[model samples]
Target chain A: MDALRITHVEGTALPMRGEDVDTDRIMPARFLRAVTFEGLEQHVFEDERSGSVAGDRAKEQHPFDNPQYAGASILLVNRNFGCGSSREHAPQGLRRWGIRAVVGESFSEIFFGNSVMIGLPCVTVSPDELHELMERVEERPSAVLRIDLTAGTCEIDGFTCAIGLPAAARDALVTGAWDTTGLLLARYEEVNAVAATLPYVAGF
Target chain B: MGKTLLQKVWDAHAVRILPTGQTQLFIGLHLIHEVTTPQAFDALRARGWKVSRPDRTFGTVDHIVPTRERNRPFLDLLAEDMITALEKNCHDFGIRLAGLGDDRQGIVHVIGPELGLTQPGMTIACGDSHTSTHGAFGAVAFGIGTSQVRDVLASQCLAIEPLKVRRIKVDGVLPRGVYAKDVILAIIQKLGVGGGVGYAYEYAGSAIDRMSMDERMTICNMSIEGGARVGYVNPDQTTFDYLKGRPFAPEGEAFERAKAWWASMASDADARYDDEVVIRAEELTPLVTWGVNPGQSIGVGGRIPSVDASLPDQQAVADALAYMGLEGGKPIAGMRVDVAFIGSCTNSRLSDLREAARIVKGRHVAPHVKGLVVPGSVAVKRAAEREGLDEIFRTAGFEWRDAGCSMCLGMNPDKLVGDQVCATSSNRNFKGRQGSPTGRTLLMSPAMVAAAAVAGEVVDVRELSAEVAAGAI
Candidate 1:
């Protein structure tokens, strides 16, 4: 994979309000049965939005199902958004569902790491700022929300709030340095040299 | 101040600090299963990358393998394709695979410890979240994404941020009926679901010290549910004794040297911690999930929590109640169950089966409920059969089947039908986690699940244990 840089994303916002929206809810386990994540877009939040399995026909109230947030490219969520299962499909499903970036109060450690590798940067803002951003987006669904990684800020119609990203994540997103696989390949000699001395590896 | 066990293990594995400011840590062992590795291997092939350390990696088919049938060409075409893909990928990459027919084949977590592949003072990685299950051996094991799986395959290292260590001590003796599963459930319930974020939990104290190797594994397996990316128990005599004489463990003089090194990996008496919490083990009871999340649990005979703003997060509680189709403030013991499942990485070991069999013998499943028992691994299955545990289950009207992760997360054919409420021994009680989007899962211990299977409703396992002891069955 080539180094991919993500300096900024400007798109409409899909607002979701909940704490600890785990990965299992993000992409249900049944969808994980597929060979690949190709058709995951239709299944993102399948249980929350569709109620297809239960046939409740109530049209579960959720932001993703709202026509106003139809093509939104950025997702705005509350604290601990991806809290369960370490499956990469949580982010993959979101990315497949047209989510290019996530702005939240906090994210689970594994979810954040998975997003970073896929070039989807997850930024954090204060509760006050998040409330303001959500209100602004909900008021005008079509308003352009800008998330600039280089500037560490989110802007909506001249209203800007400081966003926080780890310095390392920011540097990697800006300089297209997130491809750790290439770095590992370049250090092949070092890895083998280290592996040779380990008893477990030798036993194998 | 002395460093904790987590720091000592992490520092030993740290290769260097990369330009991105992430630590380039070497992974000593890489475990893979059929469900997560296909995409990873494809990505590696797309990049024309060869596995840098195939010798250190092991493969198995667990998640999608049917627990009821041992025949090939699975009834589920998609599951069959996944198995074939994993087999081809392992062969092409020179990775050793413990396929269905292999004696070693089983859940990735169970086979690792039984084969003695899991050791102290090592870094382990796998595509499955239960990789934390391996941390019970004192290694820092992490569950990686498919992309990271590709990363490990090509480089045998992962770029990660260092985590703070929180020491959790559970002092005093455990009650007679409370097992390791109950201990972990109680801890997660008290700490909330997201309490351990950005921290590695170091389990200790008298309770953890007295636990057997299998019991320790059950505690560590669900660390992910508590929001901790990794959880570990410091290696000691118990850990060493469990690994000794196993298939992959060091032998003879080498074993002595290995034991000495492993003993040195425990946290020092004066080790510092980023945070600390203590609980008295005697105060714990057999706990079960009352709602969607693992943290939304109460004691077996306790009432379901009333969802309101006064709770930790009222919105979450309300949402959980709504998803679970349950009313608040009701007794949890009388909830009806349509199915009962016992088996998963969490509580599918020999000891777990033995305890469940003891409760189930001379009893029969409730007419309204369907009961199934899937062992963790082939070895566990054979061991259970030799002890007539399978016969006990079958005679009690429980379906005795092959070994795999059955009814756990609904990855295979073993799944709950729509709207079915299942009493389960597996971890995670999330809505629709048992296959059907509307299916309900109540997480409990194996003994509790067995009791529910016969009662057709949630009942206190202790009550059943007492009856079994008095020959009431």
Candidate 2:
């Protein structure tokens, strides 16, 4: 019953189908001015959702802007989601905008790491499974989708499929150890010892 | 099985295995910049902790600094505030900062290697994704989130999951006018943007071995774009020669000792890898991105890809074509460009500037195109000016600007106006990357960007080089 343990996530899903949806598209660089990540929810996908890009044909029906997907806590996306930039702001914005978890075909390594650090689970499903989940969410935006990290399964409308996450990431999320500062600090002496052994740190 | 350089470096830096099955890895060097550190510092305060190893940390102001104006209290209040916060944070945390007035001030990635702070066999962490740029020196460096930034600040350690090593071998000599930028672009195009996920790219083969250290950095800088969190080259004579006598690098006997350790850290001849990819360098040409991502690119002589309904990435291609306002099957050459930017951590070093200057020496930018050349660092600026590269650019109708990541990400005032097509040397071509929401970006080599500026469109740099040799400019 630990509040921090994210063994399972169940909520409405928002489908945004696009490969390599980069961090810049998720949160534009202009909004990165503030020292804190506050108020980022209002600006998530600010450019795409608002059709700010000139001649952008796919701007009209951005899932973030669609009213049907409002309050959706799970985001379903295609491959290579969050591809460019190491900005934690992208995942922060998604989390703040009511996205608790993401199910995608694939994710960039940095983006995947950033999401886990913030306790936003990013699981990968097979292409077929992701397509089916996206189609289901589009057809029934209010349908509840459940992801169980411990069991590595995603269930929607009684259709069950395996989801993939790194074993370490799954353990961190299930044990509430995703915010790893304390876990890292527990071995502070060992860290210093390792640093001392490095030739570069000791100036050879 | 023999060990890859990644394995050796990882083993060296690993402190302990955490309870969650992740390794607690000690960071040898931590680089910080204005955009990502304010919150990280605040998090440290909340935890009642101090930076465990200030000596290992370095800070700089780059993302929000204006390349045009060097004055205090920047016109952009938010930019000014960011710099001020970094200044206060560095001072409070006892970390050294290369502020705007400092001669060493520049892009974090640029200054780290320039000042010899990035060394081989060490684990470097930065808040910026281009931290992979340091891996050119055979280091295990990767970008981290702000929370990990706080972790390194508090304990000089991070909970990290190990990655598999992928050996990307680019053999054969590069044809003239095909630069390191094109090599990486070709790799990204061949391997889908996400192809390198869960892997550390160990760049090898004859072509990589022959490249200068600066060129190696350019190749490593964009590894993140290919979804590899870490990328590196094995340390060799090129790496050691570049490090010797640099400001922060060890002196004389110590340097000799360090070089031995670095060379030993290289991957063994029989090192095992999870996967292997081989590319022929001679087959590559000057490449350019015509879509929203780095992977959506074509060679200078190739046409933009047409969207076929049955293709695996058809929807992605269609979306890219729609956002870029480009037609399918059109020749990438002669695509109109309104802006030309020759700067960024990817291609703003001395050799990059020299190549661009060589192209623009006797030519002028097209009247309709705005051209800029921002150096990567103040030292680079001074060096370029000393070589009179600035005069060459200014005379060629390109604005010679101060150091920083000028129009690369457009964190500063130098940006593309609405819908302007920019032929740039920056890494990412993500939509709105250069400040304008709809501004289009074409990623190319610096020489190609220079040639594009002169032609006011995309043109083959090899053809332009031939024309330049014929005195046709």
True contacts kept of 2: 0.88
TM-score of chain B of each: 0.99, 0.99
TM-score of chain A of 2: 0.95
- lDDT by residue (A1-204, candidate 2, tens digit) is 256789999999999887889999899898898899999999898887645544254545777888999999999998899989899999999999999999999998889999999999999999999989998888898899999999999999989999999899999999988888888877577887898899888889
Tens digits of lDDT, candidate 2, B1-473: 88999999999888888888888888999999999899999999998999999999999988889998778878899999999999999999899999999999998999999999999998999998999999999999989888889988899887888999999999999999999999999999998788888899999999999999999999999999999999999999999999999999999999989999999999999999999999999898899999998998998889988899877779888888887888999999999999999999999999999999989989999999999999999999999999999999999999988889879998889988888999999999999999988889999999999999999999999988887778886
Model 2 chain A: weakest 10-residue lDDT segment is A50-59
Per-residue lDDT over A1-204 for candidate 1, one digit per residue giving the tens place of the 0 to 100 score:
234878989999999998888888898876777667798888888886745644344445578888999999999999988987888888999998999999999998889999988888999999889999999999999999999999899999889999999988888788887766886677667667766666556552
Error of 2 at B162 (Å): 0.9
Question: Interface RMSD (Å) of model 1?
Answer: 1.9
lDDT for each residue of candidate 1 in B361-408, tens digit (9 for 90 to 100): 999999999999999999999999999999999999999888888898
CAPRI quality of model 2: high
Q: DockQ winner among the candidates? A: 2
